[model samples]
Target: MFFVDTIELSGLGNRSYLAGGARTAVAVDPPRDIDQVLAAAARRGVRISHVVETHLHNDYVSGGLELARISGAVYLVPAAAHVSFERTAVHDGDTVEIDAGLTLRALATPGHTPHHTSYILEDSGMAVAVFTGGSLLIGTVGRPDLVEPRLTKQLARAQHASVHRLAAELADDTTVLPTHGFGSFCSSAQAAGTATTIGREKEVNDALVRDVDTFVADLLAGLEDIPAYYAHMGPVNAAGPAPVDLTPPALADAEDIAARLAAGEWVVDLRSRVAFAEGHLAGSYNFDADGQFATYLAWLVPWGKPVTLLAGSPEQLAAAQRELTRVGIDRPAAAAVGGPASWIREGEEPASFRRATFADLADRRASGDVVVLDVRRDSERADGHVEGSVHIPIHTLHRRLDEVPAGEVWVHCAGGMRAAIAASLLDAAGREVVAVDDGFRSAEEAGLTECGSHGDGGPTA
Candidate 1:
């Protein structure tokens, strides 16, 4: 019997898979961190015999080469990828036999990238599952704009054809597992759920339901700004990602930490939003290690700039480092694990800002003393934001700070997580900031007027 197990990289909202018959298995789209994949294979009592990549990923570095080298598995990549590494290049209609009854067939599925492919797993002549890496997702398809902008429209059209081809070729009962759309920015639309079957996606997927021209238009229209780090991911993955160094980063003393801050280096606070808002280093920015740490941190920090992590404990520091490395932010200059009290004991003054509920902000708004700043994406703001709130998506806020009017800024996002990050940025820029750490629905309930047409509020990460 053939089985498949999911290995989720929750920090990036992506999933990798382990599938095969009892004695041997295949890994699909493994992340840069390969230990988890190894553990999953061991738990299943199967040795990974092959590692296949659906495409050159644009969101995070892949560990396929390293994983294959370490395990002596055959590394398989699409023939059209033109990668610089050694691999058995696969083509459309190609098949690889894993064990007696299990085989993987490659299908050319281009859209997310110029040379993307999907795999169909068959057990004893019966189709069991299709691993649609970035092509066909749960409710949507992968955004085509991650590649060259000129190719986006062409890729979107190709994406439509790819899904149609999958629906036509695969059996209705074949499981449809995808890698890029679970909440990641790579998705063209928000996923309806975590899992779906080929038949169900054919019946309900927007890309599959619409005509080719309409699908292309809608897909292009739905795409948001791609993260800055994405431009670097393809090259790194193509060149081959180095095995991740998970050793605890060197600890920096308070003086070194303060000096880095003084030299205009990023000192990121990875604690919770509440903890960060209560007390943090004066210039340190809050990115909450609990949230989408890799995506947002990489998005905000300048590429190749040195970073120092500040966490509440050794575990937090390690977790933060793991997430950062997945996106190619490999070695931090240094990390300090502790609280504001430690910095205070070292003669460093900590900074803090006020946190307000939607109700409190509403009261302040009534007094005409607060300037409401909505830091959600344009798509999110279009889905019923508080009336009269100044709009600036969190990702673009760093470059667009000059556009913000001078005032006591009251910041908010869909949830408090992003608001805290925004508040920290504004605070670091010397603005009087109040983080409105509350749900968007609460603003409506508190009698704040809601405006804008409703549509999918897609992921802020």
Candidate 2:
């Protein structure tokens, strides 16, 4: 039987895949770092015969072109993508054989993007699975607002129709595999389970169970803020992404790290929130390697500016470098691994901040002047927030620092991860800050924010 190997890009909340049999395979929606796809092929003892993109991705740079070039595989992109690359232009109903028994048939699933296509893998003409790039995600669908704003509703309608088409055509047993929506900003709503079948989705997916009008309305209403880096992904993918270079960047000493920060460049610290809160270089921002490091870092970093990575260990630095490459941040200008002591100069002590819980925040508020900043996105804050916190979505916090009210600025997100990141920014900017390292549900519990008797103290959605 023909087989498929899933390459989960957990950092970006998407997945790439290698599918085929008979010593030949096809790579689907590969990330900019093609080594993973190549390694998968090597493990399976297959030669990559084709590299295909379901669409010109808007969430991350696609590695299809580079993968095809490197492996000497046929590169296939949707015909309507209007990209600057050369290769096979896949259109609806076009079929290509991957191996003797495995064939790929393209179906136009316009919605995620105007040209988005879903590829069905058929073994001896029997449908086994469908690689739904951005269409018909587990519980919801890819957001329709990424493309032209005027066409949002139009695409939402198309998205609803596309999901219906897949459910109606594919067999009940046909496996449904999607590329986005595992906490990726590309999803219209949070994805439901780990894996799903076409039949299972028909029962649970809103697109399948609801009418088109209702589905479109619900999807449009529920969409979250798109990542700032996404504005760059589409054009880069359209022009064809450059090959990723994973060579370790130049090692930065304390002086080099300080110089980069002084030059208005970024010095990112990839460490746990607790470790970062304890002590870190004065100007470095904390983007914990333990959380969605790549997405949040790529979202906030000034594009094209050089970045110096500071991690607690060599392994953490290397892991973060790999994650950054996927979103087209090819190389860190420099890197430093080891404790903050190594990166902090001999004279100046490492800057440290206090981490508090919601209860501590409430107690502090009762005593004196303090500024509470909610760094979550607009949609999240709308649900309910601390009565007097300033709203600044983490992505736009850099330019809007002047707007944050004075007084001891105690910042928080739904959970501690983003709040930690925000606290670093404020601390770096010379503001007295404390990271509220507790869950938002505790807000109501501590009388910080209203909650349902009890909610997941983590970032909901």
Candidate 3:
């Protein structure tokens, strides 16, 4: 009896699984890095019988199709798979029997999207492990607003029903193994680090504690703005992502990078947002390397199109390349050999951002003039937050920019990722924005408690 489960954590913190009884294994929600999954399975001496996608993920391109193509395994999806592909679409209650006694039962849990589903493993009488795609997480349920606006209500209804259904049907001890983990933008209430059981989550999940109406309101309130590239990814993934070839083009001199850019290739700046803002290739896309870089680049850079990497150094180029490859942007037109300065000498450059430390933001907040924008998720805000700070949750900042006053506004995240993004958006929108370099934690440590610590990001002053 092989009851062992191997969880592979991708660089971006996505969890893909290889689970089975013995010789047969099932891979779920795999990223574009299929080779890593395969390598792990080979070490365990198990044959990958099926590649499964719980739903059409908007965050990262699924590699299940490509893995199936290369390994001759069956690719499995839900019945709502409207995309044209050679796949086995299972219904809400369909069962995929893996071996003599091992089986996985699909449950239609459509809240994140209309087609989302979850799986329950059955080995003996009842299974205790449920593979929740985005319907349920350790500390929160999936965001209901990812679908259509009208669908948000319906999805909320379905989401509540689905979670309650799981709570009612499954045993309390059932382990919840989810795809999205803590840092990913998929769920706001994702547990900080550890996995949780259904029993524990039922007691703590804020969305579950409230009635459906309150749940809907709470769910929608302060939801982060979906990324710019999220909409562009769904169609591409559904249609089957074009194959990625990692072999870089023949030695084109540093000058050739400009030719590639002029030829319609996009040069993606992989440095921090502040670094790019300071100075970069004028026309390069400002997709920083820190947060969700590969995920965004997949949509921003077309497959097979030339892309030049503008990273910190030669060491960063390989890392940047790997991140790009995760989402299938494996080719490099060429890396900026001489760095950003190389491009500037060629007369092509991009803008950079101005950064302020926690001390700087605190001083500004003390003046009672600067609007403190906390860009963390709503759940994080609810935990505890900086006093008197306006909450926009990063994602919704653009749509609600009018709400933020025109004067100097200090922006920050739990650490610094969302703050950087929010600051960039504000700067692009012609607002005076300063990103707090140290973020909230630093403010607390510095003993600047003008604003009580609410456990959110940092204090306003």
Candidate 4:
């Protein structure tokens, strides 16, 4: 008998897997943080015999090489990855036997990347599940634009074919487990569920339902700007990622935090959106320590720049550090764990802004006292935004700050999380900020005039 265990990297919006019969297991698409995988293997009383990479990941650093090295497991990668490390290079149709009555067969499923592959798990001769990585996700296929921009169209077409190939070759009852698209930007479309069967995907997956040309066109047209940190992940993974450092960062005093800030380093406040809006360091940006913290922070901060974390508690600091390390933002310059009152005790005045609901902002706008600032992605804004809101995506706000007109800037996104971050930035820049800490839908419900065509971007809820 064989079983599969899903390890959710919820912060990254991705999943890794462990599958085997009884005595041994194989890890698929593991994260840079290997402790969780090790813990899972230990709990199962199974030795990790092999670690596999479906492709070179572009969203976060991979722990496959380090995990394999520490466990004496065979490291297997697709022959086409062209990685500069020692490993077993596998090709399409290659099979590897595991302990008990299990085997893994590689299938070429290019699209997310040129070397992308999917694995079919079999017990004896019966197909059990397919680990589809980024090729075939829960509801849609992986976005093809993460690679060279010139190859996006080619890859999109290939993605369509690759998904069909899986549908044709795999059994209807076979489970489909994918590594991307849970919430990550790597997914071309929103996933309908976390896990599905081959039969279910065949009946519903958009890539499998549409013609190759239409799939390619829709995919290319839907891609938004990839995160800035993504540009650094591929090269780091190709060379091999260093083992993650989980040690709690050194605590910094008010003077040290002030020096780093003076040198223009990022000081991120990992608190609740509301807490951050109420009070924080004058120059620190707010990326609440929950819900896609790593993704948004990595997207906004420049690559390789030094960063310092400001958290309200020790646990918050640790959680923020763990997420940051997953995206290769290792070794924060320093950390300060306390609320705004602590800093104020050190004689620095804490910064704060007003938190308003969509209805309040609508009333203010009608009175001509507020400038609506929509900080959602262009794709999101295209879906529909508050009418007459100044548009600037959060990721680009640092460079585009000058474009916002002078007024009481009322900042918002699809929801309040991003609005709080933008409000912090605007407040830090000496602009009067009022965070519209409510859902985008509330703007319409509050009778605020709305504009923009409806797009594929889903609702905040």
Tens-digit lDDT track of model 2 for 1-461: 78899999988889999999968999999988888899999999999999999888888888888899999999999999898878899999999999998999999999999999999999999999999989989988888899889999999999999988999899999998899988888988668788999999989998899998888878888876778899999999988888888888999899888888999999999999899999999989999998898999899888898988998888898889989988879889999989888997889899999999889999998998689999987667777789777899888898899999878899988878888999999999999999998778878878877422333433541
Cα lDDT for residue 431, candidate 4: 94
The alpha-carbon lDDT assigned to residue 455 of candidate 4 equals 45
Clashing pairs in 2: 443-448, 443-449
lDDT of 1 by residue, 188-216 (tens): 87688888998899889987789998878
Scanning candidate 2 in windows of ten residues, the lowest lDDT window is: 452-461
Model 3, 105-155: lDDT tens digits are: 898888878888898877765776888888888778777676567888788
TM-score of each: 0.97, 0.96, 0.78, 0.97
TM-score of 2: 0.96
lDDT of each: 0.89, 0.89, 0.71, 0.87
Tell me the tens digit of each residue's lDDT in model 4 across 126-204: 8889999999999898989998989988898899999999999998999999999888889887789767998998899
